[model samples]
Target: MDESAIRTQLNDAGYALVQVEPRLQGLGSTIRPDVLAWAADNDGVLVPWAVVEVKHRQVAGHSAALRQLATIRDQLGTVDHYVVIDGEWFRADRGLRTATPISGPVSPANGADGVLQDVSLATSLIQERLWNAANRRRHDGQRLDSLELFADLLPGSLSGELVARSGHTVRADRDVLWRAGRRALTAFTSQDKNTDLFVSHPAIARAVAELAGDAISGTVLDPFCGTGEFLWAAADRAVAASRSVELVGVDFSSQMIEIASSLASAAPVPARAIQGNAYSELPTDVDLVLSSPPLGLRLPTQHELLNGTSTKDGDLASIDVAIRSLRSGGRAVLQISPGVTFRANGEAYRQFLAENVRVAALIGCPRGTVPGTGTGSVLLVIDKLPPTKTFVSQLGEDWEDQLSSGGAAITAAVAHLDDKTAKAT
Candidate 1:
């Protein structure tokens, strides 16, 4: 009936008590539970088991205690059983149904056997099996043929609407899927020292969208789009401007391409994603280009720049591709490595820009703004026209605040470019 007795009961039930009043990291805040325990299978593999809340007597606060235990279970990232002890009586719930009486000591047996098991444990095992099966299919160069199949394979807790409108399955939430995809890509790219998977900053992506202005229409492209951050931003800008826009994103990794496609499909504007080498294959004559391509690497042999006996760095190669893909008078916003602006090897690419495009602005991003790397970047805005006075600025420590004003600065500079071009005509 008391806390000590409950602990003794759990110990006798083959559950190892991990901690009393344990603090767990939740989605936003830390959650504290009365008791944390683990259950070991026949092979002695310990898994998270239950969270217990002990109450001295049945009172009006029992409902609140139940709710608190439920929150802790949800935050634990698994269907761990939540047990409540009210004197001699105890009940357990896995968030699937009402708490039921769990008399006597708990059992460590999981749902692997043919016998019926706890609802929560059974659901968790089923989901894990399905996930493993899906992964195996993917490894064998196959995919789930239908959403219904995926839904049927899913546990009852997640059986409804297996696939969202975005093509994201109910197997995981967007944030979970995003993190998993990123980890997979990072691991894949880690095999080659020359390869890097850089995720764009939300602040910078928003700034790029703001700088694109309200007049943007027609086709927008992100040839090296990783997870489609720029595409989402561009879609928002197009919606705000009341312009009909078509967005296209390309990435070399199939996983990244899949995430990008799902995100694009969920956007308000018309968008699509392609999985391929951005340098070798991309749509042409785009009205606008927004991208943050991988840097500090040589262009792969399959790249168009390297194919014709021209070897360039990855960043410069991406810039060249962006330039060639843009329509006449179209604009491009590129996030390039800092070396591209000052390195002697980059001078030829700079000269190419000077001769073929109008340099609008180069805004230096502060260090630590990009994810996974501390390397600074430069946002280069170029228009395919004659040269003009380029506005240059370096963001200080308060770079986010500075980037917030980027739209106004870009607007004025674009107006000046328009005025200069008109006079020249």
Candidate 2:
């Protein structure tokens, strides 16, 4: 059904319909609300609760769900009851706190434009208002914090993981963090879905972990550990699998280290974040060295003055440092940018990878893998080959497929590479 018809049916149920599109007339060019609704008392002194949006399609509805939740959160200053109404679908979602789908698709004999759906949706909305009415009366802003926002935007599996990782401690109270995370997750659905918060995306993390295996025993280091996500996740999985793992994160950005430290403090395996260059000065004798370095962004410290654009000296230096830091039979997972994987000049790094390190896998991450960062990154699992003299050049498409294969392939590669190194030594 069209938006207007849906809006009309919901309005009948005491909803103050706000058309989010076409910018809500003379209010302002910017005052565009999908739907504006209010729950009133007998006196009707603008009873402070507003439900926004009458979403139609599923995809756009999901996006609208996040945007509206954020709007509801923002509108908390003026009104308390904020909701996104999806009267056309099988559910009528309501509330500023969480994006929940109420069963609203029962078809009645006299029902038109899905009356059962509308009624069910309305009923849930009313129930939600009742639940929040007392809280609003108490003026509890914490009641409608961002958890609703996150749940609205993020996928369920990812959200569950974030909640699990947040644990007990941190600056924000448990409820407050829960709310902010939920809000961010929900908002993430609408925000750039490509940027991964790391802890939130387990599928990708699991893929990386599978390759890591028993390769990480003593210490695992992430050179460009953004917010220490990989290290915390790695330790969590390792501990679960009965592997004793020590985690360390090194990043140039102090802000990232602080953030990573906060998350680590909440996790079972506490991680250490030191502000140092990944390439030049990494901790010594690490069992695993992993990093996702910055691409194109130049650093002045290691400038060799190669070309007009300077050079990616820091990344190159870090790669060299990571290699030397690893002990024999040690492994590393380099999260390489797509440009580094395909470009001709990248042949040097690829060759360096093939010769100095065993190319166990080269997993191709889909475009949207890293949220906020628009670069496609691949997981490059490498091990230090003893005698350090196997000179292999150029990898084919088979390299991609090799990484895509599961644990068995990785195990076989690690065993074979270890055997070859032993024989050579």
- C-alpha lDDT score of every prediction, in listed order: 0.62, 0.49
Candidate 1 per-residue lDDT over residues 206-311, each given as its tens digit:
7777666642689999988876777777776777678999999898876666556655654567888898887778888889989888867685463444224365
Model 1 clash pairs? none
Q: Which stretches of candidate 2 lie above 4 Å from their native place?
A: 1-201, 301-315, 386-425
Clashes of each: 0, 30
* Residue 302's lDDT in candidate 1: 35
Which 10 residues in a row give candidate 1 its minimum summed lDDT? 111-120
After best superposition, candidate 2 residue 154: deviation in angstroms? 18
The list of candidate 1 runs beyond 4 A from truth reads: 1-196, 301-309, 405-425
- C-alpha RMSD by candidate, in order: 11.6, 15.2
The C-alpha local distance difference test score for the whole of candidate 2 amounts to 0.49
Per-residue error for 61 in candidate 2, Å, reads 33
Best by lDDT: 1
